[model samples]
Target chain A: MATAAARTFALSAPLPLDNGQSLDGVIVAYETYGELAPGKDNAVLVCHALTGDQYVASTQPLTGKPGWWERMIGPDKPIDTNRFHVICANVIGGCMGSTGPASPAPDGKPYAMRFPVITIRDMVRAEVALLDGLGIERLHAVVGGSMGGMQALSLAANFPARAERVLAIATTARHSAQNIAFHEVGRQAVMADPDWQGGDYYGSGHSPDKGLSVARMAAHITYLSETGLTEKFGRNLQDRDAKSFGFDADFQVESYLRYQGSGFTRRFDANSYLYITRAMDYFDIAEEHGGKLADAFAGTPARFCLVSFDSDWLYPTAESRHVVHALNAAGAPVSFVELSAPFGHDSFLLDVPALDRVVKGFLA
Target chain B: MATAAARTFALSAPLPLDNGQSLDGVIVAYETYGELAPGKDNAVLVCHALTGDQYVASTQPLTGKPGWWERMIGPDKPIDTNRFHVICANVIGGCMGSTGPASPAPDGKPYAMRFPVITIRDMVRAEVALLDGLGIERLHAVVGGSMGGMQALSLAANFPARAERVLAIATTARHSAQNIAFHEVGRQAVMADPDWQGGDYYGSGHSPDKGLSVARMAAHITYLSETGLTEKFGRNLQDRDAKSFGFDADFQVESYLRYQGSGFTRRFDANSYLYITRAMDYFDIAEEHGGKLADAFAGTPARFCLVSFDSDWLYPTAESRHVVHALNAAGAPVSFVELSAPFGHDSFLLDVPALDRVVKGFLA
Candidate 1:
């Protein structure tokens, strides 16, 4: 069943960004599950990943697909929306009913490349504005995974009083060189597409689908564990007894990745992909707080719970331990665990019973 | 100090391929170093990796750069060219003077996508033909790393008596699902470019350089270890005091990757990249030998040495161990070592002093 209708809230004033620019007339699109308590103390904010939107426990409007975290957000699920109000919003540089590069500028044209570059902290500022408009000065918990995990950490660090408990899964406080390198490849792929037309392809009939698909294909590989891929596809042929000795998808894994890539282009905007990835690349909480991670959590009252998947090379358990060590140095209440999973960085979005238990227990 | 000039040998007959097809009028491009023994037993056949050429111990004509294995070859080096006759051949699908997609087809046009797909064994077959042309009955050794390693393994498995020793470094006997997935991404990136023109970019004035650059960028990341990247580039800015808040290469890693991507497009052919990577993905010695790896090495008299880098996730030590186990099962003499190096799959190409000793001792 459809869980909740999408809602939007416009900030009364410009939202200040880390890049020394202000985003004007910003509108945050969000979805809520369950009801807010009378004291507004039972509100939980769930941030989405790089490509995720606001359909936390409902069907996505564009793809008619179930919410990314549908398995963990319903009644009696890990998130347990019946017990607490759950809110999820599309990030600022996103395209899903949010103010982003696809939004119209003062000239009544899509901002396209003119969209101000954003950072993880800038996204949090927009989220905080949304929270302020909702009359919720504090969240019972701020929870996320991947890019969302970055946001969870950002809110806890920047707006220390906004979240009482923070749960960040499979994430890092700083984007590594490898991470930036991968993102740069994707960006270059999109920009290289003739159809991208300098990111001004809003109504040009043709978009950088080919390049975006390639970008998605590359990113999809990072989301999966080598063991998981070997177990699922191996050297299996793609419905052929012998290789066609051509450029076609001969291996099942190749076919699967191609499908993943092409399907992604149908629902994503190339410009938004660029903007979001740039935001992630600029994320460095330690650097933001005078180059000391411990200083980022100083005087924060939030109880932090960090979870990592063993197979996630993108944001490995070592990154989580780094954060935990910093929290320890900051004398903050923090709990950390590296759960075993074969899904890599996508484990948080996949069916991992251990992750479900961790989320449920941490929230409780 | 010019080691040798390139030479080409035309196969006397059509070359039989693994896909039941035949390649006609094939020409193998190669180079030689040092003097051949009167008995020809001092001959060493070196197989170059993807994107490498026959300029093994000389300056590459196209880029004016020293050979890929320059440090490991030449007089007094580990391979000791002064004491052994070294021969390196560009593979069939390569872009050098070899017969490849860029070469003229039967109709006097570039083969483009019409070129038949090749396998690692097919590549070994070509090398065997080159040896036959040179009047060499057997090789003192067959040496390679990465895709080159695949060819060395193929030579040992398919032509057991042709080589007295086989040295394979930082490679796998079979392309894992992850390996195939990454290659597939690179392939898709190339094909997505309009300039690719279905691999018919030859003589088209413009090539799919953008797409190939993106592909190279992605592959470049897999070549380096995370720890190495952190130590080399980290989140350091690129000649700047602050973030640019734009799509420019603000991070040093991004700038480095961009330079690498652009510089590669100059000296490489996109169509050759597609064909070579395809050959690599199709590599599966176990499958080629009735689903048993040991069967591939059955009765092989060659002494084998397999080297892997501890940080090489692309083709980790486990893959080498698998080959070693199979060699043991076949009662073949085999030695394997996983050297501690931070360079990942590129460790074999980098300066790792331990590797030099191992290669010298193995060849001796």
Candidate 2:
């Protein structure tokens, strides 16, 4: 049945960060599926996006929903977990049982806003610690989409010997100005809520649900394509024959957005959202490597496969192409494709048959 | 000097709305530049966008800044005041001295949430009343961009004999799902504010400034092209050499957005934003005309001119093309042009010289 059980690993050493700070006693929460080969060479690491946890092929305890990539990671599925051991871990700034903002500090108090800012590379460092803990010296492949793709690329670049194959989908090498701007709006929405109480709302009986919901609503729009929204909702009334002439959710799209916004608050923490989005905004492999993106992957041993969606404007095909150019300059073996999809950036997580083919072929 | 003096007019009768409700004692704020001419044949009506007021060719009283479209509407510029009389009016649901949510109702209390939902056609009806009060039947041309373009199209569709020419720039005949979704996010942000107090916070020594600021920030990003933002603010640090590692606007883009959000709350009303955005979301000339946009302009006398900016993703060139197709099907005299500009949807208001030339030639 390949039912995965959640596990947590506390690091034996402090994890260093690019921001000149170190997180002490870091705990990484992860889930594993399939059986590990005796030689331990058939391992594959799967990364999750902004709001994802490490429930890879299991059910989420909070929402009782299937793991985000369950369709692609089951036995004989595209990822083919029967032949490959799969591991997925929660990022450091994430709130999914990992040592995050909601975790206790040295004083046994919730870190809340006092948690040190961490970068994408810092997240990779924590992942590397998890890999070390698992005693897997090298993985057959590391796969991800969206922010997950950033981690896959980060693994390939910063820790060259960690994985043999790197598959990144609908991701960018660096956050664009528009990307930073959008994340900033989300952060502002979260901070603006009076219930936020400067991120000290932990155990307050009242959370910044309204602010987080607004933040989620603003961000949720960016994940879907304009055409998709038009096709799905298209000015259709929510539940009435005519407009309510009031502030009630009149349009189907508005109703859907409100649902997405309110629903997100139940499973996500506002402070963790702030930190993760900031890390994403600070992500710039080129900046980290003397302003030359090619230098980030210099003499890399990993073979790279990059996939972008034609409708994904959040991280368009141009971004993938830019990364391809850098890989080419670095003399790395790489392949790229821009698959057609109607779901925009969310196409990575949606049912895109071509994506399945690409992932399967790349991992093989 | 082509300085426009602010003026206001009270409608002698009630203003009818599409929502089966009428507003009594409606007031419209306006500004006029140059002379009306002996025959009033040289008069030109200019409609303002959502955030725009009646300060077309004058300094804004609230901020002491030049009028938004001053460069395009001066004595010698396009829509030249020397050659024609120009009048600009604040939409009835606007906060610039117009009868909006902030205005008093028959009970002598602010309308607040009690303001009747208005449509673009209803706004034109108020403009028509204002024109009648001035004893001038619209001649020459009516020009607008964005939401103003919606009003221009509405005037041509409903009051076909009011204007000889209609110039709609960077706009659409109907709001797309994406458009409505973005506006919904903004509205939600405002309504989520604790200080909103169910829209009755007026004179309470506090307003939903944070919520309204967040809304403005979200909208401001849509106003510019991705390329423009990259070129202007890329990942540059904000007045510092390195990231602050804290949530204090480390990036220049974040600083810019925060500044914009905070600054907007100073000169704009929160409830008015809600009302105006609602009106825009409800705009669909085709829906009002038996699901055929061509039918909206049937038997129209005005010559139509539509200009779209190539980089505008908000109301892209495709939207203008859609309107042109409808106008073509209706056998209307319409000229369409896609101008190359890096500013995106705000191209109509920015220094897009091609737009200035088009406005001049079309009006001439």
How high is the TM-score of chain A in model 1? 0.99
Q: If you assessed candidate 2 against the hidden native complex, which CAPRI class would it receive?
A: high
Docking class of 1: high
Which candidate achieves the best DockQ against the true structure?
Answer: 1
Report the C-alpha lDDT of model 2 over B1-364, residue by residue, as the tens digit: 4777879999999989999888999999999998889998898899999899899789999999988899899889988898898999999889999899999989989999999988889999999999999988866998999999999999999999999999999999999899999999999999999899999998898899999999999999999999999999999998999998899999999999999999999999999999999999999999988999999999998999999999999999999999999999999999999999999899999998888899999998
TM accuracy, model 1: 0.99
Looking at candidate 2, what is the lDDT of residue B196?
96
TM-score of chain B of each: 0.99, 0.99
> Clashes in model 1: which pairs?
none
lDDT tens digits by residue: candidate 1, A1-364:
3278779999999989887879889999999998899999889999999989999789998999999898989888988878889999999989998899999988999999999999999999999999999999999999999999999999999999999999999999999999998999999999999999999999989999999999998988888999999999999999999989988899999999999999999898999999999999999999999999999999999999999999999999999999999999999999999999998999999989998998999899
Computed on C-alphas against the true complex, the DockQ of each candidate is 0.94, 0.92
- Candidate 1, superposed: residue stretches over 4 Å from native: none
- In order, what lDDT does every prediction score? 0.93, 0.93
Residue pairs whose backbone atoms clash in candidate 2:
none
